[model samples]
Target: MTSKTIASSEPSIIESIDQLFLRFIVGKNKIYKEEEYNDGLSEAEQDDKELGLPAAEEKSGWNQRILLEVEKDRVKRVEADKRLKDKRNALLMRYFQQSLLKVVNDKLENSESVISDQLQLRENTVELLKKLLAGEPRYSVLASLLELNPGTRNRLLSLVSSEDFMKALGRDPRNVRDIQTAIGMIGTDVLRFLVPAILFKYRINAYSHHNTLFAKKLWRYEMTLGQTCTALMHDINYRRPYEGMLLSAMVNFAYVASYQQYLSSFEVVRTACLDQAREKGEKNRHDFFYDIKTDSASLQALLVSQADLKLSLALSEKLFQKSFPHLVNALKEEVEGLAYEERTTVGKILFKAVRFAKYDQLRSSRLFKPEWQDDYLADSYIEQDVFKNLLRQELFRFKPTWS
Candidate 1:
C-alpha cells in the first residue's frame, strides 16, 4: 500500500474539553485486526498497514537501551517539578500511555498478545456474545459457547470448578462434582453475569502482558469506569443496571479503538514525513514533530480522534439504543463537556460518571490533579458533597476483586 499523506495545509483542530482526561487513557489494543472494521480496504491501504510504522527512530541496542532507560528515569525529575507538576506530569503521563501501547503493539506483531495460547473465538462469536449480553437463556448461551469456542468452554468449566469461585457462590465444591452440576447450581442470572463478564473482559480489556506497568491498572480503570457508570445509571433506572454496564463496555471499547487508530494514523503521517526528509537528506524529524503530540493545528485530527467513537463499536448501535437510547449522543457530547442544563438526563449522568471514574483512577495511581478535582464547573453538575460521597465508595478507591 502507498503511504498515507498529510494535507498540504494544516487543518483547523477543535480542542475537546476531555482532552486532558483522554491523554491518560492511551493504552494498547490492536483493533485493526478485528476484521469487521477493515472490510473493503483498497490494495494501497493494505500496503500502508503492512508497512504501518513506529515513530521513534531506530538506534543501536546499547544506545536504544540508554535512550529508553533514560526516558524512564526522567519520571523522578518530572514528578519533582513542584510548581509545574501538573502540566509536566500530564506530558509524562501521555508519554507513558503511548509507551504502554507501544509495548502491546510490539507483542501483537510477534503473535504474543493473545490472552491465552489455547483461547480462541468463532466466526459467529461476536453475534453470539451480543446475544449472551442481551440476556439469552443459559442453556442456549452455554450450547453456543460450547459449539463456537472450545477454549471458552474449557476456561468456563475451569472457572466454575474452582474452589474459590464456587465458594463465593455459597456452594460446597464437593457438592459440585462436575461442570454440569456447577452450571445447574449457578442458575441463569449468575450465568448472564459470568458469560458476559468473561467475553467483556477479553473484548475490551487491552493489556497485552502481565509485566507491563499499566496492564492491570488500565484494566482496573476500565472495570471501575463501567461499574461507576452502571451504578450512576442504576440510581436513575434501577431496572436497567446490567444494560448500563454493557453500554459502558461499548464506550470503553470505542475509546480504546479510537486511541489505536490515532496511534496508527500518527505513525503513517510521521513515517511519510520522515521518509520524505530522508530522501531530501534532512537529518532532523522536526517538521512533523510539531503537528502530532503537543503543538498541532488539528489537535484532535492529529492526535487522539474523539470523532471516531461516533461510528460503529464492535457491537451494534441498534443494540445500544434498545438499552440506553440517549447514550449514543451522550458519548459524543461528553467529549466536549456539554453544559449540564443542555445535556439529556442520561448525558448529565454519564458525563459526570465518566469524569468521576477517571478522577478515581488517577487518584488510585497517585496522579490526581487538583485542577480537575477543584473545578467549580464540574462540581456544579454533581455538587462537591455528592462527588466526595461517590469517591468514598470502596469500588472507587480500590481495584475490583476481579482485577
Candidate 2:
C-alpha cells in the first residue's frame, strides 16, 4: 500500500521551482499578476489565477497601435512639404517679364539725345526739318530728335509739342488756342502734347490747300508712326520690332502733341489684340522686316540689326514722294501701275517686292543733289514769334500765303 505513491508522482521539486519562477517574472510586468497577488495566495492561488494570458495579448496590441500612428504622421509631413515648393516657382517668372519692358521704355526716353548729336545741330538752335524724305512720311523728327539732348528734348517734349516748337524755332507759326482746346490728351512726351509751341506749328501748317501742307504732313507722320507702334506691340514676329515700336510710339506721342482726333484711333489700335492688329499691320509691313522669316531666330536677329536703316530708307522714300514728288520721279522711272489706286494698295501689299523690283533701283539710286541728300538740312532763321504769327495767319486765312 505504501508503494511510493507520491500524489501521482508530483514532479521533482526542481521542475516545480522552474514553473514558479517563470510565473513570477511574467507577473512582475503587471500582465500575469495582480498588485496583491501574493497577499493571501501562494502556489495554489497562482494555479487558478490565469495571470499570463490577457497581459501578453494586450502588450502586443499596444505595439501595433504605436506603429500605425507613426506612419500617419509621416504621411502628413510629406504632404506639407509638397505645397511649399510650388509657391516659390510662380513668383520668379513675373520678375523677368517686367525687366524686359523697362529696358525698352528707357531706350525710347533716350532717343532724343541720340538724334541731336547725329545732326550736328546746336542744342537750342531752331531748325525746320521736313516731315517727309520720300513718298512715305519721314520720321525725320524722330531722326533729328535722336540728335538733340534727350534732357532738353524730353523737357521740351513734356512742356509742349517738340515738333511744334521745333517748327516755331524754324520760324514756322503755331496757334496756342487750337493746341489748348483740342480733344484727346494721352501724352507720352515729357511735356503736354498740346503746348503753345505745338499749336504754333499747327497754326503755321494748317493753312488751306498748299498752306496746310506742313501741318498735314506732320499729322501724317504721326499716323504713320502710330501704325508702326501698333504693329510692333502686337506682332510677335515683326522684324526690327524695337525700332518700329519706338518710331510708332514717337508718332503716337506726336498725335498727342497735335491734340488730333488720331488719339482715339491710336488707342483703338493699341487695345486691339494681336489677331486684329495683324490685319492692320500687314498694310504697313512693306518697308521693314514685318516678321521673322517663319520661326528662324537667326534670321530674326539679322533683320533687327538692319531694321533702323531699312525702315529709314523706306520712310525716306514715302516722305520724299509727299514732300517732293518731282524729285522722286526724277530719281527713277515711275512704275506702270503706281499711279492706279488698286496698284497703290498693291504697292503696299508688295512692299517687300521693292527689294526685288524697280523700286529697289530707286531706293538704291544715289542722290543727284545736295538738297536731296539723306541728311536733314538746317534752317537757322526759324524763330518762335515769326512762326506763331505765321501759324495764326494760316489758321485764320485758309489759304494764307506764308503758311
TM, every model: 0.53, 0.18
After aligning candidate 1 to the native by TM-score, how far in Å is the CA of 177 from where it should be?
9.6
lDDT of 1 by residue, 98-167 (tens): 5444443343232212212211233355455556555555675556555565545555677766788767
Tens-digit lDDT string for candidate 2 (181-203): 21112122212222222323332
Candidate 1, TM-score vs. the true structure?
A: 0.53
Question: Where is model 2 more than 4 Å wrong at Cα?
Answer: 1-210, 221-229, 245-403
Query: What is residue 219's positional error in candidate 2, in angstroms?
Result: 1.5
For model 2, what is the alpha-carbon lDDT of residue 222? 34
lDDT of 1 at 345: 69
Error of 2 at 92 (Å): 75
| Candidates' RMSD to native | 15.4, 38.4
